[model samples]
Target: MDLATLMSKGLVGPLTAPPAREASFPYGLDKHGLHEIAEAAYGDRAAATGFLLAAAPRPPRRTILLWVTQASTARDMGRVPEAALREATGGKARRLSLVTRHATDALWAVEEAVVSGVVSHVIAEVDSADFTATRRLTLASERHGVPVTLLLPHICEGATAATTRWRVGPQPSAPNRYDPRAPGHARWRVHLERCRAAPALVGQAFDLEWNDETLSLNMVPGMVTGSPAPGEAPPHPGFPNRRTG
Candidate 1:
């Protein structure tokens, strides 16, 4: 059958374009639609989660966020702590979480949350989603004016109807100025695999740092070097080197 015929019969997802408007990186992502953030590799889900939390648009006052997670993803990555959410969102986030037994259930929950008109935003972590599922989410988010973000595993691939797709990986954090032995603010290497808002920027990559003090995410020049900043001592050998939060 033809593509249009399949869509009409609910055998395939219908593809749609985002609203026409000038859009820029970062902020433009806040537009009403579905976006996907996937891990660059195994164990990079933490980095992807961190990026989503730090970069997601702040909801208007009084509206809470809806977070949906599939069982497998939740068991592997664990839930975000209340303190971490407070720190990441600068204490402005009021969140409701839901755990589903399967990816289909998680996707259903996301769509329901979007159409419910109760949540300011929706975030979901699922094991996988095909193009049809993503397209449904995109349509719901755009129609309801509620933004949705999907956190996917590294194995996620192939076509998707999301407005944008980002692959995030952890990077060595900048040196700690207060104490060189300690880890500083978290950093991530974000690669834009696909972008409907800015097609030309599809393959661009960015090195970003999350500043907890300023509650902002900023792009840095390049990867941080091993040398410490002026007046700071080198990292101590006794302390184990690990990824920063």
Candidate 2:
């Protein structure tokens, strides 16, 4: 049996409790198959766009990002703007062919990519969705082994096919460990609204700290459990110097 199971059974001696698991989005923008970012904070589309542009991954070809955007969006939240998407992917986005359509069209495209076996990833930004669409996409994504990420507006409702749903928001910058007063690049609070991959981590909140130098997020560990008490005393030769009456 594993160490954890043995400890729980009282078979092992003293043991320390496991660390609390914290939810973090360290896989960059692509970790969750998200190709579009929402401007939930600052109300500026540029901020979200800029963040994504600076975080897109680079690797071998064979991945497809289906950007679906609304034609009526004022801030261009429907799909990652071509310019911004291009910048984020370091011009690789230029090869992406956008299928401009309504929310329903976008959802259908995701399913198509999943079954086609040509696209490795699919991203859809929609206004409103229902349970049926999400259900179909979920099955398609699983069967085809392709990752599909949905970017919804503030009023997103209904069901979803995503493995995890997150509410990402900007957080106050963490103080620099080296300079104490200097401000860090940026920080975010990612609330795991849903997680099918790891149910045990559901409802867990993570305080993510971003490092600009390494362009990565290092999770801040919290609530470390103390060591358990020993069952028996250790052997010793010492004796009391004084005795009570």
- Judged by TM-score, which candidate is best? 1
User: Where does the lowest 10-residue lDDT sum fall in candidate 1?
Assistant: 223-232
The regions of model 2 sitting more than 4 angstroms off are 1-58, 74-101, 175-183, 221-245
Candidate 1, 81-186: lDDT as tens digits: 8888887776776999999999999999999999897988899999999998998888888777788999999999999999999999998787777776788888
Per-residue lDDT for 105 in model 1?
A: 91
| Clashes in predicted model 1 | 0
- Per-residue CA lDDT of model 2 for 98-158, tens digit only, reads 5555777777767787779676566665665576677666556555555566655655534
Each model's TM-score, in the order given? 0.84, 0.60
- CA lDDT for candidate 1: 0.84
- Quote model 2's TM-score: 0.60
Task: Give the winner by lDDT.
Answer: 1
By summed lDDT, the worst window of 10 consecutive residues in model 2 runs over 223-232
